[model samples]
Target: MTFTDVLRYTAFSSDPEGGNPAGVVLDATALDAAAMLRIAADLGYSETAFLTPRPDGGDGPGGRGFGVRYFSPKAEVPFCGHATVAAAIAVAERTGPGDLVFVTSVGEVPVTVARTADGRLRATLTSVPPKVEDIDPADLAEALAALDWAAADLDPALPPRIAFAGARHLVLGAGTRARLADLAYDFGRLEALMLRLDLTTLQLVHRVGATDFDVRDPFPVGGVVEDPATGAAAAAFGAYARELGLVDADADSVLTLRQGVDMGRPGVLTVELRAGDPRIRVSGEGTAIPTT
Candidate 1:
């Protein structure tokens, strides 16, 4: 028999029921990939975090470093932002909020946890260097068809592209909030397309204000119909927006992403881009979910 301590946390919201929930394992030194996958599948969240302390006593006080792995119910993912936040907060609750370094499949990620003015813990993760690529016309058409969205329903300004920070996400900008809402996509179709493209999610967004937007992610590849609050997609969208000059790319700017509203689990994600840096910063609050 194998014993594993799994912690439940909701990231990107102060309310436990209002954010994306993730399973977090603080110490997974003894678990292998099969075990981790089984644990994640059992939890049935979009992604779960598994952490093993760095053998070298890597960084931060008392060598606050870990080798973090993210797993969806069906498979392992390169990186997961919300899970990272949950894991960071899980550690901070025990060791006090501070800086920590995580060696992920994508790269080394630096995270900072601090207490907010309202006395809530907030975690911010800096993403790996990101890049944006234009999607093939046929692929874009297929994706739109799967989502039941026509070209006219898309925002001509944002354009479609695949963006990668820690993970690859297809970014599609909706022309209107109504278009962004009413998400009814073909699961198998989207999953097949995502698998072919090696995509983690489809970032469907609608720009409300200059720096404010509503976003949704279709994560069929992760065995989840939809992701309530997606930090990875948010990071990728930030990179795409910057590259397209949708936001100020030459200066520091912060963008607000409102997600999960249509799903009734509303959550907010803050994305920051600094001048002269290709990396994106995603920040959100996480709370532990009381288990019975």
Candidate 2:
């Protein structure tokens, strides 16, 4: 019988008290779908990652490479950025920092891990090519109603759209940071709309600068009230901002996203965009959640 080694790591922040927490099963080859889901549900974090290494001597942490699947407490998701970072750092801690590949349901993701001079481990995940689309007016109204937000509360410059990197996110920009911080919504109504539209989270954002944003995600579909430091949505937002000509497309840009302040778990996510590359890169530091 094989035992799966499970650990908890927080992504996008060096402090364990900050960032988003993820359950990491470095070895999950023996587990079936039911077993994995059960583990994830019992953990009750936003998401948990399961790894199944390739047969060619890839069964160890930071081995050659591995196949990764992400599961929320409720259901499996296509991709999860924070968990990806958490897993990468976990592997790098054991095998040293370098490049790693994750064969995900969406596609192959290339991640580079490195240790900083300050003794922090950070990982960057390049997302699949992102796409931006228009959302129906009815759907938009429904989302606003559920959140008790008026259409006038939206930032006219940013607009509203559906963005996709590895997973689908509904992007709505708030005119003010205060609006972004206040988040009390109808969970069931939002969940129903998210299910119908296949949305992973609602990316509520307020631009602080040309490249900095204060953001929040409502993830009722994931069986979580909110997500702190949502790197997946940050990647998708990079594409959305680029599409709207909010950022320079010809120059490499670094975007900073601040999240989870109101919930008291402040975290930061760094999003990078290359001049010609269509894929967005989301980077953040990860720290181990100490066993208590």
Candidate 3:
């Protein structure tokens, strides 16, 4: 396919102008890795998704599945949440909404999409089973130094963690909303630390209420200064919150994450966790980016 075949969709917001924009290549059968990376670099989005049909698929959505891959402007990632949501919405617009599976580098991720009553398409993706681990003291200190944040700036109750749903994220909680708003970091330093830690983004969050949070993601490793709305990070944060008992893990819980407001590209992501289920489900409204 030609370069213009790429479609743009904004995830986590019904308004195209309000969410994280992602490039979606619904059919990438003719493109190779180098070509895909070139397209992503040309688009300059945080991440772009390239999908090829999976014919030897197992169970799910009409035996029609896709092998999906994600590439940032700099490199390929194991998975991307906003791009996943965007691609699902793109396919749903064509094939109609239902169950669809994406065989990713990490594992198979199941996605469900349906049109909302308001004429917007909503997509929910069930992440691979999530896990959380402790961060090394040296690494934690280095990350804080890069962000120009001190130990006192952190919320002691939330603590620091490394959580993984589809991709790895270092979870850090701010003591105040202002802490999250004022985002300035040494890009080279933070990117080096993240590369060493194999982290995708620093999931910096400020809890607004028991179930509301304001999140900002620093993604220097992806060649982006910051990610406005990060669904993968949100999913990992949901798992982290459940493990820390920040939410009722034994019961059904839904949390709202408000992101990108400081950057003037506000987006909302909904994270859902069910009782006895380890997998996190992240849902959001997607809109087509106007081609002008």
Best by lDDT: 1
Q: For residue 77, give model 3's deviation from the true position in Å.
A: 0.4
Q: List RMSD in Å for every model shown.
A: 1.9, 2.2, 1.6
Instruction: For each candidate, give its TM-score against the true structure.
Output: 0.97, 0.96, 0.97
- Candidate 1 overall Cα lDDT vs. reference? 0.93
Candidate 2 lDDT over residue span 1-292, tens digit each: 1338778999999999999999999889889988988899999989999987854455435435878999999999999999999999988988898888887899878889998899899999999889999999999999999999999999999899999999999999999988887899999999999999999999999999988999999999889999987888999999998898988989899899999887888999999999999999999999999997
* Segments of candidate 3 deviating more than 4 angstroms: 1-4, 55-63
TM-score of 1: 0.97
TM-score of 2: 0.96
> How far off is residue 48 in model 1, in Å?
0.2
Clashing pairs in 1: none
lDDT of 3 by residue, 1-292 (tens): 4433899999999988888999999889899999999999999999999998784644555334899989999999999999999999988888888888898998889999988897779999999999999999999999999999999999998999999999999999999988888999999999999999999999999999989999999999999999989999999999999999998979999999999999889999999999999999999999899897
Lowest lDDT sum, 10 consecutive residues, model 1, at: 54-63
lDDT of 1 by residue, 151-211 (tens): 9999999999999999999999999999998899999999999999999999999999999
Relative to the unseen true structure, what is the Cα RMSD of model 3?
A: 1.6
Distance from true location, Cα of 52 in model 2, Å: 1.1
Query: Which runs in model 1 stand beyond 4 Å of their true positions?
Result: 1-3, 60-63
